[model samples]
Target: MDKNIVFLLNFKINKASSSRKRGSRLIQNLDSRLRGNDKRVKVKKRKKFVLLSLVFNYILFVIYRLSYAAKYLIN
Candidate 1:
């Protein structure tokens, strides 16, 4: 009877550990997939920000040139 109890306990422990390993593997896969998507989104956002900044700078430069021309005219 004692041997049977020992065998049952061992089996239960092994089963529980295998399930835990599977769970951890699933989580790892999900995390990697999310990270891949996040990187793509970050790259797209960075490109948009660079384009916007360039446009904004061009507008500012045009305004400055216009103001300079006006000053010259007034003088």
Candidate 2:
């Protein structure tokens, strides 16, 4: 009877350890996915910032040209 009890305890310990390993794997997968998503979002935001700066520079160029033309006409 004592041997049977020992065997049962060992089996339970093995099962519990396996389940813990599976849980750890699941958490790692979730963490990796979140990191990937964060990188994508950062890339998109940088692209948007670059596009906005380009547009602003174009507008400034146009304004400069218009002022220069007006000065020439006045002279």
Indicate which candidate wins on TM-score: 2
Candidate-wise lDDT, in order? 0.73, 0.73
lDDT assessment of candidate 2: 0.73
Q: Following a full C-alpha superposition, what root-mean-square deviation does model 1 have from the true structure? A: 13.3
Please, what are the lDDT tens digits per residue for candidate 2 over residues 1-75?
368755755565565566887656555554555456655677899999999999999999999999999999999
**What TM-score does structure 2 among the candidates reach?**
0.54
| Clash-forming residue pairs, model 1 | none
Q: Write model 1 residue lDDT over 1-75, tens digit each, in one string.
A: 368755755565565566887656555554555456655677899999999999999999999999999999999
Cα RMSD to the true fold for all candidates: 13.3, 13.6
Provide TM-scores for the models: 0.53, 0.54
Model 2 clash number: 0
